[model samples]
Target: MILILVKLFQGLYVSNSGEPWVEEAELIRRAQAGDPAAFDLLVERITPYLYRVVRRLASDQNEAGAIVQEAWLRAWRARHRYVADRPLSPWLVRIAVNVARDLWRKKAPLDFADLGGEEIVLPDPVPGPEDQLTRKEALERLVRGVKKLRPEYRMVIALRYDAGLSYKDIASALEIPLNTVRTHLRRAKSVLRLWMEAEDG
Candidate 1:
């Protein structure tokens, strides 16, 4: 029996190694076996990507951080239901995005005075003398346009562009139909393009 169990585990490992290293799949396997260490690994691996997506959805850094922390806790509690054969990242991201949306809705309406903090603090904004003003203006316009997007459209766009998720993955993460993902992306692009053109004009 011992030898059989060892062989079975070895085979499982080999099969898993041959497959893709998606976040959900690995976490499911480890979590199913009650491995806390694997859960931690999953969190660390997805944190940076999740942070960017959450940040894009949130109005500010503080809110984004709070949402992300809540998302992780949610993921932890839900780990028992995770299916090991599926990709874990999308499942985790789906939860995170939902949490972000909830926080966005729960936030108090912003006051007009809150708009006073308009200065961007990115490092090295001017790389060269040529095209500096044009590049800066374009980037600012893009940020403004993104910020103005509706929550659903912004979430999908951020997941696609900022978090680098495929359409299928985004669909899975957002718990929406694949066709809806395509629709949202299409609408988001049209709106962003119009916004960018208006800014340019």
Candidate 2:
């Protein structure tokens, strides 16, 4: 599986100007019929986006990568149940999120201090060293704030922001009502804002 993942990552980095999901339905059909090559192709194209979502929930890259791999393995095993006509991302994201939640149940609380290295864009494009430092500090504080949120709120925030899923998609992935998704996001943002403000003062 590690060797297969290494090959998948190699394909992920290659420049493919074509549409990522142009023939995704056909690929899904083939995969559902037990085509490993077709399934590998789909994994190659989708892993980067999946990794971003998993990375937000995981304590570190190693945990995130493990979750991603396990998600794909589970997806492959359940391929027969997936409808080719439906959008694939939500289904896959649901699996990844479930895997993360399961892991969390067995481990310590999530640590966001490692998240400070993630990029944060400021309004000033040519910021000085001081500005850069300030941005990093602010991002660290925001991550710390995220750490304090309830598990459901953190899941909604990661799905909505890191994965860039629509509210409806988040609802589907989380098996929750659309209104609940909206409520969680609103409350989570409010809590994070207050936490950041308190930290700044």
Candidate 3:
């Protein structure tokens, strides 16, 4: 199965002009019908986005990769339960997050202190060496602050910013209410701001 999945992933960019690519909904429908190729296509398209979501919770690249693969396997098994009309990303993200959470439980205590793989890019209106240096420093501080956040806050932050998920999508992914998502984000930002301010002082 792993070899097949790896081959399908490698073939993602292979030209298939002979056949037009199917729409995502159709792909999902086909996958639900147990079409392996359709499911592989879904995996190819969704893995990058899902990895970003998983990386935020993972300790390192290898763990992140494992989490993503396990999530895909679980997704394949649960495809029949997936609602075809609903968007696929949030559902997949939820699975990935849960997988990471379960791994955390089995390992040592969950610690966000080392969650530092994703690059943070800040746009500068006036681009220069000095501006670039400042942005880099700010990004470093922000990442440090994020590492200090509670597990739930870190999850929301990862889902909202790294994964680029909407509030509703984040709520769905985390199995929480929309208001709870908003509250966590708000509180997270506030804590980060306070942490940064204290650092400056």
Candidate 4:
């Protein structure tokens, strides 16, 4: 903890800086011990990661930010319960995923905008009109497929693929068995594939 505090003076060893930094589990341990700065540092470390996770699973920039905040707040409240041996990223992700899922359940509707905001960065300045159209159609079909799933199935799809969360993370987030998470993801992909294929046909 002393070394971590010292490093904070130098930017917490930004990941790309090629400097060794405090691991998330240690941060969480300190946070659980009621260290405010430790908790703040932990939040600082994972804010972008949380934002990316929520952005992929849910929609709206402001909404995603809010979800991440909510997740952090919830995590803070439950920090004492965290298992220190397990890495903190998955736990944080699980909380955010649950928060997003709960919000989605309340909304009870998926829209075009909900599936919007995915950034497509291409090096080429221009893609041909046909290629552009192909990409557009593919995205539309993918969104449509997403809209067709049940809420639970949709959550897994969004968390596992869209958000790039592990099956274990999904399980912890959903408070279900690991195998259940796998099943949900497997069934979700199968359903979406069939739906997309049917749409194509």
- Which 10 successive residues of model 2 have the least lDDT summed? 112-121
Candidate 2 lDDT: 0.79
How do the residues 1-201 of candidate 3 rate in per-residue lDDT, one tens digit apiece? 355445544554553568777899999999999999888778877877887777677766678778889999999999999998788988898998888778877866534332222233456646788888888888889987776777788789999889899998988888899998877787777777767778989
Clashes of each: 3, 0, 0, 0
Q: Which is superior by TM-score, 1 or 4?
A: 1
* Candidate 1 lDDT over residue span 30-115, tens digit each: 76677875665566556667777877888777777677778878887887787766666677678888898777677664321111
What TM-score does model 1 achieve against the real structure? 0.69
Weakest ten-residue segment in model 3 by summed lDDT? 112-121
* Local distance difference test, each candidate: 0.69, 0.79, 0.79, 0.69
- In TM-score terms, which candidate is top? 3
Candidate 4 per-residue lDDT over residues 24-79, each given as its tens digit: 77777789999977787787676766666666565556677678778878988998
Better of 2 and 4 by lDDT: 2
TM-score of each: 0.69, 0.78, 0.79, 0.64
Candidate 4, pairs of clashing residues: none
lDDT of 3 at 21: 78
